[model samples]
Target: MSPTDILRLLLKNWKLLLAVPLALGGSLFYFTRHEAKSYASETTIYTGIASGYSLTGNSESDYFRTSNAFDNLLSLIKSRETKEQAACYLLASHLQLKELDATQLSWASLSRMRALLPAALRRQLTGPTLAATQRNVTAYASANDTNELYRLLNSHDPVYSVEALGKVNATRINSSDLIKLELETEDAAICRATLALTTQVFLAEYRSLRMSQTAAVIRYYEVESEKALKRLNDAEEKFLVFNRDNNIINYYEQTKYIAGEREYLYSDINKIEMQYAGALASLAAVDKKLAGRGASLLSSAELLRQRKHLESLNTEIANQQLFARQQETDAAPRTQQLQVQAAETVLAIRTTLNDHYAQLNSVEGIPSKGLLDEWVKNMLEATENKAKLEVMGRRKGEFMAEYHKMAPLGAMLKRIEREIDLTQKTYFALFTSLNDSKASQQNNELTTNLKIVAPPFLPSQDKGGKRLMLVAGGAFGGFFFVAATLLGMGLLDKSLRMPAVAQAQTGLPVLGLLPAHPTHPFKKTKKPAQASKLRDHSYEHAAAEHLARQVLRRVSAVPARPFVAGVLSPLRQEGKTTVVQSLAHSCNAGGLPTLALYPEGTDAGPANDYTRYYSPAQATLHRWNLAELTQPRAADVQLVLIEFPALLEATYPVTLFPELSLVLLTLKASRSWKPTDQQAVADLRAATAAPVEIVLCGVARYDSTDLIIPIEKSKTA
Candidate 1:
């Protein structure tokens, strides 16, 4: 459907459009007429969530954290517990008042409260003071869920219920640390009292929660710090015990000293070994110089005894020197004494050797004294070096043993020290955290900065009612509802209500349109002449004549005589008989010989000279042949208009299609076109070669103006 059609449809249902909205809007206005006047009160508080100072010092505000904090504040304000406590306080304050107190409640509110609360119950709950009454109320409310006090708090009472207090609106003011709270109620005192009590209760709860959180953190840190300290002490104690048990007093330094002494002892041993080797070689050469006579002379007991004593003296001196060196003490005195004794012994040995070899000749013909002296000195030096080497080797072995023993101690000590260092670090870190938590706890206590900047006050004027807005909203809501319903119906409607729609639905050309006139063209009347005159001047008559002229023009195109045109409909009661009768009468009046044939059982009105009825079975069997079914008509008849039964109600006369020159598919403009109608029209077109056209019958006058000439205009022409 086009936009114009939609506009036309809405205009056509203008009465309904006006009626529905007015009814709904008026109903809303009437219902809200007795709505109580609302009084609103607001309070402003400094939340200090974004830029607050505390004991911990000021810091840059984080956008996300600040937003979350504000969200938490708002949520707390609306929390059930907070609202319930506030409601309890307000209720208690109201209950304690024996008479009207303007500061606490209005006259109207006091009366209502008295009506809600029985005298006996009110006395049972009330106390001497507001605080006492509040305590009593809290205790009574905690008794059970079904208790009167608890029920009052949970009920929908405007002053005492948690639900009523939930109306308190809390919001952050821009990006600042300020928050605004608002509430509306039937009474000014109730609005102010409710907002004030809610703010107080929420702030107290928020502070308590923050303080508890910080305390919990502090406690956790303290516990962890204690554990860390215990671990550190254990590590230190283990280190001390390990040191005491292992006899380790500076193990690294002791091992270092042992290593140095061992290196020195090895050097000394190596020097002594070289000296012993040189001495032995020199002694052998000296012995060779003292030939066979020298050996016999040296065999004397005195010489042997002196030589053995000198060797003993040298060995004793070397022993003293080695001992003194290892002990890290002065060995010069002992070494000198032993050296003197060894020198005396060497002189004596020399005297004996000289006496023994006085007349012995040397192997190279040299004197025997020099060779004997050289042998004696080499023999003593070799003996001393050998003894020194033995002593140094023993010392080196002791030093190596000490070094090996200290090696494992170094690793054990390192491990203990590492453990101690790690434990100490952990303990210190936890201690620092504990201190920070304490500081934060203190900061939290100091920064409970929710201060009411604008306390709520008793409202002097009542807030405006929403009656007008609700009425307007209802009216607009009803209007749109009706429009949407109409739009949906129009979109879903399949009725061919217009000539263009009929042509589209049927897939056939619309030859003409017929307006729905009150005067039935085929109805019988007592005064036939007057009925005919009335029908002649009707718009339906005029439209039918126009349709008949168009059909005759098309029929004239065919060269066949007695052109047969069948008028068919998809269903009964679609004005097919009227279309057929009007077409025949118009054609006959226009000087064209026309014959109209309708079904035998159909109500086609009294037969006339141009109209006749035929049996449906005969028509179907004989293929609608005029001579076979109807009485013989005038030979000059140029057109035969046959009105067939509804296609959906009876079988279509397919055999009659060969004889027809044209088929007019008549459809009711006010009725929907179904798939059955399209199927019937499709079968008819497929069965015959004749042209099929649509005549949209029973159209409103406004819809048919474009297709048919008006009766006035036709008469003037």
Candidate 2:
């Protein structure tokens, strides 16, 4: 279609385009109304940290920590633990969980309580599973965020989802500043109990954590002190042993005595050695003389030599005796010298060994104050007997120093022991007192430091929004659906709706345009048999005749004298016959002498002389040859409407009628009637004996109105 044509079509069908989406939206709204209404009431809770307990000096850290801490607590409230706790609390008060368990519980049973709870309750608790269908899924309220308390309350059951224990359905309603805790059950009292129990549990948990923290600090310090005391005791024991066994005491004196003893023992032995040597010399001389006397008596050769040796030995023996006599004299210088030398050697050795003797004579020589071995033995004996008074006295002094230093530890140990005893006593007392206080608090229903700022109120109607939003949501959904449908239709459309699109494919000028009828001609109907038959006849007769009237009118309006109008399109079934008849009638209506002609087919076929409506007064309608038109006719018709079917024969131009005002060809909009189809019409125009104008017929309509038309009855009848 041309841009003008497209714009016209859009303008005409604007309501249809909009209605599709609107209807979808309406349907969505209608269906959503069946869903249950959820209402919420919220009470604002300002959780504050007390003055003395905070460390950041009124900073938001306390609030931040509280928010974090409460997040876990809030989760715990909606947890199965909280559910069981709530159920137990309710049970304790003679209220039953049978109703709640039946409606709100999941279908899965807890393995821990499956055996304990009744079989009916087991069915109430369901294991989480994927939804079989998309619609069966339920939404969840976030357990971490505590800004809304109603989420906690509503989240306990799918009938409602909550933000917190005391706040429920706040997101679904107005007046959001308040944390509304909604109880969705039919019972009002149960809702109140659930809220109250949740608050009490939160307080209990907070206090328990506080006490544990304080006790942990004290226990950590006590353990560290115990380890320190153990190390200190070990150090003191080591120091005591080191001081008593001082290895360096009297060391120099004992070394000196040892040096003196070594010299005396070695030097005294040299003096006696010289006296023994002299005695040995005198005995040698006497033995030699006795042997020589035996030798002198023998006169043989052996005896003569022996006598000579004996004589010499007797003389030496006398000299040795004299010498021995001199050496034996105490006053003899040599003997005196020897004695003195011995004495001097002994003295020198003693001098060399002086330090050794001093060591021997030192106090270490004393039994009580001896070397290490002796002292150790003695100390051991003394300790066993408790008899060495001096050793005991020194020991007492050493022990006293250590004892004094360690005395504090002993006192501390005793103190810690006392503290432990006291703590044990206090622990018992505190435990008893705490139990009593707890009992009293429970009995009195005392308000804890953690107070509930706002109690859950019974909703008048409901604090949440109603089903209108669902309707709006459905409307939005419907709008998208319609848009999707239109976009899909546009995308899938392959038929040529625009002339430019066809021209782009094949560069052919659109010679003429046949707008779609105000009403669509081809559509199924639910009319009665008579009405259908009437409608069919009207289309065949009146509608066909109308086309012939338009054809004649177009031919006369051409700029050239006696202009020929050709009705043509891309394919068949585009009402060329109808256009031709309509044009003829239009010419006749205008009081012009007109003739309707059908082109002759080759070989004298049915196209050569096809009969149209017979008329006695007006011009006869007949198939005429191209050769026959060039020749003169019986009368000079001012207007001639030619009806030509699209033919693809090569000899079609030769068969074209002569003196043709215009070549009129017709084809359907569907099929392969592209720009090439226009070439067929252009082919006839080129072969015409005269100038030719092309006219298109049978455009399809987008609506029913475009295809309907009024019927015209024949006046000649």
> lDDT of each model, Cα atoms only?
0.82, 0.42
Candidate 2 lDDT, 1-717, residue by residue in tens: 345544555555567657765776677667765664343333334334322222223434455554554555445545644443444343233212333352222233222233433555334332233221111111111224442222333355422233323232222123221123345543344445555555555456655654555455545545655555555555555444443454322333433433443343234223323433443444343333333332222223543343344333333333333345423444355435544543454344333333223223223233211332232233223222222232233434544564454435444444544555555554555555555544544422321245456765544454344456665666566556655555565556554444433334434433333444412332335775765567445534344434545454555576544444444434445555555555654456557656555444312112212212222112123443533443443244566555544455322233435556555554333334455666765665566655443343444433212322435323333
For residues 1-717, could you state the per-residue lDDT of candidate 1 as single tens digits?
Answer: 678878877876778788899999999999999988989989999866678887756746799988888898899999999998998899898898877899888898888878887889889989988899999889889889998878888898878888898899898888889999999988887888888889889989999999999888888888988888898899989988998998888887787777877787778778888989999999888777776767877778897787777767766776688678667789898889888887888888777776655664576777777777677778888877877776677777777777788899899899999998998988888888888888888877777757899999889998789999999999999998998888789888778888877777667888987777635555579999998787777777778877988998987898888888989988898888878877876788788888888888777677776778877876677675556754678678889998888888986556777778888888889898778877988888788788998888888765675577777787899
Q: What's the distance in Å from true for residue 156, model 1?
A: 3.2
Error of 2 at 217 (Å): 7.3
TM-score of every model versus the real structure: 0.68, 0.46
Candidate 1 residue pairs in clash (backbone atoms < 3 Å): none
Which prediction has the highest TM-score against the true structure? Answer: 1
Reference-based TM-score, model 1: 0.68
Q: What is the lDDT of residue 430 in candidate 2?
A: 53
TM-score of 2: 0.46
